[model samples]
Target: MSRTPNPTRTLASQTLFRGLDVVDAVADGCQSVQEIADRTGVAFSTTHRLASALVQARYLQFEPRRGYRLGTRLLELGFAAYRDSDIARSARQNIEQLAGETRDTVHLAMLDGDEIIYLDKIDAQRPIGVNSRIGGRKPVCCTGVGKALILDEGEASWRTRYQYDAERGNIHLPLETWLAGMHAYAQGGYAFDLEENAPGIRCVAVPIRDASGKTVAAVSVTGTTDSTDEARLRSLIPTVRGAAQAISAKLGGTLG
Candidate 1:
């Protein structure tokens, strides 16, 4: 009852592959009009047009002298893809387990440009904390779950992947603070939200891996600062971690 895809046809209009190529070309220090054209083997005029369009769409940046590079638009697109992906459905059980185990709000989030998109959530029974819901967005630089998922790629790589764009003139938390959190996340199995996204809501999170063993999502439990005490959070870690691992397994992850 199924069919195999035609490889050639699939590759031509493959948004994933094309998007990856665009991202890679820009990341590899490709600068300006000619550089991207030369690298992509796209005609100069066509490349110019594409670049202009991408810049307008926020997928590519055009500097006065430096030329084109990947833009925050990619993040927006990436987040949307991840949030709507099968991985999100695969992680539902994990979200439920985390919520039940911790008796707190549980959330599943996927990375967007420099933020995290809440694909799903299990609200707390106690109703003692923030009323986060599905489709909520939070800064990746500050949230516990977002930082932990980002840590799966190593500090340097995560920094590169989620680098802030000065062109947008959008600044929130300091880079140094974020870097410190990244270091902490690398050392710790789970990351802490620490009232970063909200003043009274605290959260703890673990990473969710996909079939290729890539951290594609983050599962987290959130509660009020008063309830997320050190002991309670510590007790909830293993439960959260186990749930994340189970979801990762469903996604075909082979976590090391």
Candidate 2:
């Protein structure tokens, strides 16, 4: 299934590798052109030119003495791309529809590194509104939607990615708790937020499985404590699950 590397290919160009090293050096806090050159073993002139090009492209910012740092433009572009993503587009209508149906705030979230990133939300018609914003992050260990998404990933992944913070008081819990919750989720085909993320808010989430049957995203509904009664939320599960299924279908998810 594999071929050996060509010696010529491996040895041919030092410039490409040097350029990569310069970038790595810059990212690691070698702000000054000279510092970058020294750190990367590239020529000072080359480092200067590369740094200048990066600054021009707005990937880096230049300071007279401090040299350079990451630019705000990268963050702006990243958020723009994320907001306009296919996941966001596919989930938007369903999230809104669910919110309308349940008179609750609905959210769409995805995993980003070690945390859950909220990509979009729809607010209920009530006087008080949910405070979560687009692009907000919540810890995976405590949030319902986040834990559900990971649990849907199966046991091995869950064990690999999360740890029990005993100091935080059975943060991972005994195996029994994890197993019971997962069993409930699989049986119900949906997950609960359970006021773990916030004291007063409760949420229900369903997986947005893709064509390959992978949990690529999650859709959730949130509401005030008074309205998020257990029975009321149990009744809302079908609506939330239906909305998620619609979104998954729109995104070409291979549902059986």
Candidate 3:
């Protein structure tokens, strides 16, 4: 026997979907009830009711001047989700895949007091791979992963790190040139090491962000100059960035 659909259940499901649409519209910057209704194609009265319910549930907030905005409840949920995330474990599979694809060294690193510490490293099977290991620390001014870690920082911070590296004789480029390069890299959302970290070694790197869109770590792929020429290094940028983005997505983030 064919069964007819229940009217109450159908209405409830439609209401749930409409409520979610309202939330999406608000999140996308539809502040006023009429704006949300226009965006969601819901009637004005229904949109007002939905927004009021959402405000009562703490998913949205209303102010005198500002119509609607995301409430603190979403922030609390984001924090809780990030607190339970393990970045190293989350990044392992992606980095491993990157190494396997490129047949080169892969590194996952985080900034630590003006330096970057390697949280994970996948060494290439080749004999002449980079000599970095897990827990190794490197200067933050001359390495690809190091630059990626600071992409969101201001020029003042960049100068501070550059000066620190220069005092230690770790910097080879002039401050002006390095700063210019950093500006370009920051704008491009990636960085490169043109034999700056070690002679004959080159790398491409991208930042790994957290749920709140903070650059919490970095990922890089490195190879010798002979193996990774200019064209080859440029070709590896997308692959390295893909690995970093995968890690960021696992951490409840999205890459820009």
Candidate 4:
């Protein structure tokens, strides 16, 4: 079910993701209508309509003789996004410094509905392939950077958004139980990913707030739990917060 989302994404961004499912299915070579429907869980008519919409938007092209091909709009939009994104421009230097200072992977992310998208990343001295890349998306509830980004939304929105976890097999938790932990994290001004998203990988994150106290972004330090102990990870909270605060300040954020 859909939930109230942040201003960064349209309320219908969830639906857009579903539409993107069709786009992804086609990209994966699901050529026929039936194949696309079977892959997308959308009805046959809906699939056809979505394809038509995409064709109209120039995100997809129909081949009367062939099947389908991606349109140039996707590439154009991708390039335009990278070029116009100000977060990476503002935060990349600070992220690099954080990585150098901590020797841990550092990331900058922005919330996109119930997911967070990586806007930039800086690898540490010891590279750990976290299966994450620029433009990659991860679930909000299970990620440190994600929780940090939403910390300001408080318990009610958290409850609504955290009702289901698709990647975690739709696991459900009591609202009170989850909110207690989230409130504590908010009070402390940071969050932790304790192997919640990916096994053996832990992360510490802090919210990047704008001048209006809105959490516009988040920054995180990530490392393997084996290499980064609880104490060491906790110690990184200050560094992560500093980096995030610096970026927020660069974006005209003023701590009230």
Candidate 5:
């Protein structure tokens, strides 16, 4: 009987595997091309070519004396991966807990450029829930979690975003009024929707930070105006904030 070719090995790209080996060698402290070649068992010329390509693409950095080291591009990609993985892993329990406690919809989201992307969403047990999913995207100008994600930004940025949204008809609130609300939200360390994003939906949200004290994500409890009035939404601040802080703490962050 003939042996079936293993697809994993047969379909693998040798060059790609060699490049990864080069990266792994450098990660394991092999600085020189000769050292990397020895560590990866690849030919010296191939290793040198791979290293040069890596340096040009910023996967590795070269120094005259220090040799090669991991580059800023790797750091950026690593942090983004870490942020996403850590937030999802650390926020799952807290998100579930928040949903259970409030009996309302819960959302965990992160800012992506000028938009907010939902990383996770736990729908309420009730018949009506917030119209959001794990990967839904929303404008950063009009949602509670969106505002919470930008709590650290300056007034000028706030005005620019608000004006841009207003011009596009995504928002109708005057710039000054939105700015005033944002100021209060920043001071209080939380934000509210007040039906800004949708007709009757209200939400209370708080920022989740990382060890560097930067807001990497946000958490929110959402409900309809019938179930969550302004007073009730305000009341959920502490509950929502507690969940955000719990996730932040797991991420080595502090929240006040």
Candidate 6:
């Protein structure tokens, strides 16, 4: 059993928050202990100690000259959580059909903070397919799957998410431009990524809303620009949207 915290122990609990701060710093791209300390506003020695402890605990890993990165424990936990997600499980067959029909990679994704995580990916049998994985993350503001997942959010809230990302130092995407694109996508009931997330890939996506009418996830079909130009992507929108609806229904999600 965990012991009750005395005053000294209660004060010491700040270390737990500090350690988490360091972890967040690393997630935000701070690699070295000095960088983590600088970002977290903690002393260098304290940051190093906490980072060292995290490394020992397998929450972080060190490479001889490469500094620190997220460890295997995170991958284990992430996959465990993803594998247990009902949406991911329910959407697999629908995603497979989308891929098979389009002869392009299809994805099931869920919003994670200011990002979208690929919960499942069905690769096309053809030689050309997207280079994404089941557990990879991408910026939500620029990806079709991400925009579709957040389509219901108000413009202000959308900008707020961009702000959250900016605070974390991810400012590559411009807010005003993205908001304009998001507005069009939301109105259209489907989103498109035209070389936004990747230079040569195009995608069409629609939201997966639960029975309560809450957007719970998103589904997208991805293809190469060579094979899927704007005209092709526009044509495939209905197919992708239909696939999303099928998965939503399977998940007890709303069709409307």
lDDT of 6: 0.85
Candidate 2: residue 109 lDDT (0-100): 90
Models 1 onward score TM values of 0.61, 0.67, 0.66, 0.77, 0.67, 0.80
lDDT of 2 by residue, 35-116 (tens): 8989988789988887787778787789896878877766787679877799998887778778888878888998887778
Query: Tens digits of per-residue lDDT for model 6 on 1-256?
Result: 9977698876679899998898888887889999999999999998999999999988899897889999888888888987788998888888888888888888889988878888998887777747688877888876888889888998988888878766776446677887888889989989998887777988999999888888999988888878889999899988988988888888777657
Off by over 4 Å in 6: 1-13, 26-31, 63-66, 127-132, 159-181
- In TM-score terms, candidate 3 sits at 0.66
- Scored by CA lDDT, what does every candidate get? 0.74, 0.76, 0.90, 0.83, 0.89, 0.85
Cα deviation at 152, candidate 5, in Å, is 0.8
Worst 10 residues of 6 by lDDT: 164-173
The residue-level lDDT of candidate 5 at 219 comes to: 96
Q: Residues 3-102, candidate 5, lDDT per residue (tens digit)?
A: 9978777546787889889887887899999999999999999899989999999999999899999888888986576466778889999999999999
lDDT of 4 by residue, 31-130 (tens): 7778889999989998888888998999988888678777889879877897788878888889999999988888889999878999888887896868
Angstrom error of the Cα, residue 129, model 3: value is: 3.3
The positional error of residue 102 in candidate 3, measured at the CA in angstroms, is 0.2
The CA-based lDDT of model 1 is what?
A: 0.74
- For model 3, how does the per-residue alpha-carbon lDDT over 67-167 read when each residue is reduced to its tens digit? 99888776687557545549888998999999999988999999999789888888886756586877668999999999999989979999999999999
lDDT for 201 in candidate 2 is 78
Better by lDDT, candidate 6 or 2 = 6
lDDT of 5: 0.89
> In model 1, which range of ten residues has the least summed lDDT?
162-171
What CA RMSD would you report for each candidate?
A: 10.9, 6.2, 17.4, 6.9, 16.3, 4.3
